[model samples]
Target: MLLIVVLCAFVVFLLVVGVASFLRSRRDDSDERIRSRLGALAASDADVETVEYLVRRQMSEVPWFNTMLQQMRWAANLSRLVSMAKAPGTPGLYLLLSLTLGLLTGYAVFLLSKMLIAAAVLAGIVGYIPIWWLKRRCTKRMDRFQEQLPEALDLLARALKAGHTFGGGMRMVADEFDEPIGSEFGKTIDEINYGMDSDRALDNLLNRVDCPDLKFFVVSVNIQRETGGNLAEIVGNIARLVRERFKLHGKIKVLSAEGRISALILTLLPFAVAGVLFLLNREYMSLLWTTELGRSMAIGAACSMTLGIVIIRRMIKIKV
Candidate 1:
């Protein structure tokens, strides 16, 4: 009982600390922005103070904890995932959430099953919930961005035809369209305005948005800049192509709808049946968890089901 109490206390402490750090980071970011503007306006002769100020501004409020996590190999990847998901929390906060979830889940399972192995497995799976949620958010956001890309391109082409510069056209798109697309383009414009190379800024945009249509637009712009061509015409053509591709993609999804539905039913049937059986006759279903042979068969069935699910998913996934 004491151990459990201590563990719960530790988890709560971690959560409180994580929340505090997250709020502090938000405040610090605003302060950093102000300091950056001041630093920019300061005399160049105060180079040493400027450097020190910049370094201090970049450091996290909880230096030891943040530094330890940042030094971990997965930290960079987690940060990228958080950025892609457009999550408000920092990577360290996300990690803390994951850890808390895992430990609480493991403890609950252990209490119920009195089995370390079962607890560990459940804990591990639960630990990935945050990452799974992040990936899903990123996927949906990217899908929306892709859906908006062709229209954004057309808007840009019109802006260019109206005698706006490329940067002006980008700013127009940034101002006119809604999120993900607008925000991404706005970021690229900010980079360009801040003296980043146009190609580099666009490349960064490409890296952030993971849309093939956007890639085509970026490649076209780069090619136009290097080899010389009518920018508006090129972008217009790319926009048209993207629209056609999207149409074809819709047709493909329609054609694959049956296969996808079948896969979903097939994947869920086993679990659904087992659940029903457990509710109807707990003793009969208990064999699967209570006996060695039954446990082996259950594991084998799970493995086969997982493999089948993967194969079915691949079969239904049509790439455009």
Candidate 2:
């Protein structure tokens, strides 16, 4: 009874924290929008003091905990990952969410099975859910960016041929392409407008986007600026090369589809069989949980399965 009460109280605490975090984030977003508008108005009015004060106040008041977290190497890496994924939320918020989920899932599993090892294993897996979600989002976004890049390059080449400056060509691409590519180009143009060096601005764009094809465009532009070359022709050649690489990538994926599907089926087969056996005969399947030898065997099998899955993944992954 005490355990049940404690569990319920813990769950309620987590719910309250989650709700408070959500509300706080929403309030902060609205406040930021208001402040931006006010700041713009103050700037136009030439109220330097007001603008300075607003800037000072706009800085988040980081608590000691968050400051310490930000100082850690893992936190820095996670922050970079979040930025790459274009995920909305601070590193602290993501960490809190992961911890809450892991704890809740572990407690629930413990309540159901009364097994510490199983609960811990499940908890660890649940803790990685946020990271997995972020990686998935980042991958899809990069894929979309890669798909849009060849056409954007072609547009830029055309703009250059029409006698626009490089910056003007970038602006044209920003205005012409759809989101992600358009937004990225728009940001680069904004940086250039704000007096940033063109090379530095392009480097910043590369830092934000993890597309290898974009490197060819950047390198070609940099080289052309150093030497004398037809910029339009160079950019056109890059666009054609990117298109060919994309085609090769598609062919590779198609060829590996069977291997990927087989790996997935093999990975899930053991779990499916165990679940079916449990449903059919609880006592017979319960040995895997209730006995020492069964537990050891289960651990060994899990480790072997994980190693096999990794090997299979490496075998099928083809880099273009």
lDDT of 2 by residue, 1-320 (tens): 99878877876776665555555554456654555444334434356687656633311123554567756777777776777787766566667677778889898889877778878889989988988898898889899999999999999999999999999999998998887899788877776765566787798789889899999999989888899699999999999999999999999999999999999999999999999999999999888878888888888898899899999999999998
Q: Which portions of model 1 show Cα errors greater than 4 Å?
A: 1-13, 21-61
The C-alpha lDDT values of all candidates are: 0.81, 0.80
- The TM-score, computed over Cα atoms with residue i paired to residue i, of candidate 1 is 0.85
For model 1, the local distance difference test gives: 0.81
Which residue pairs in candidate 2 collide? none
- How much is the lDDT of residue 244 in candidate 1? 96
| TM-score of predicted structure 2 | 0.85
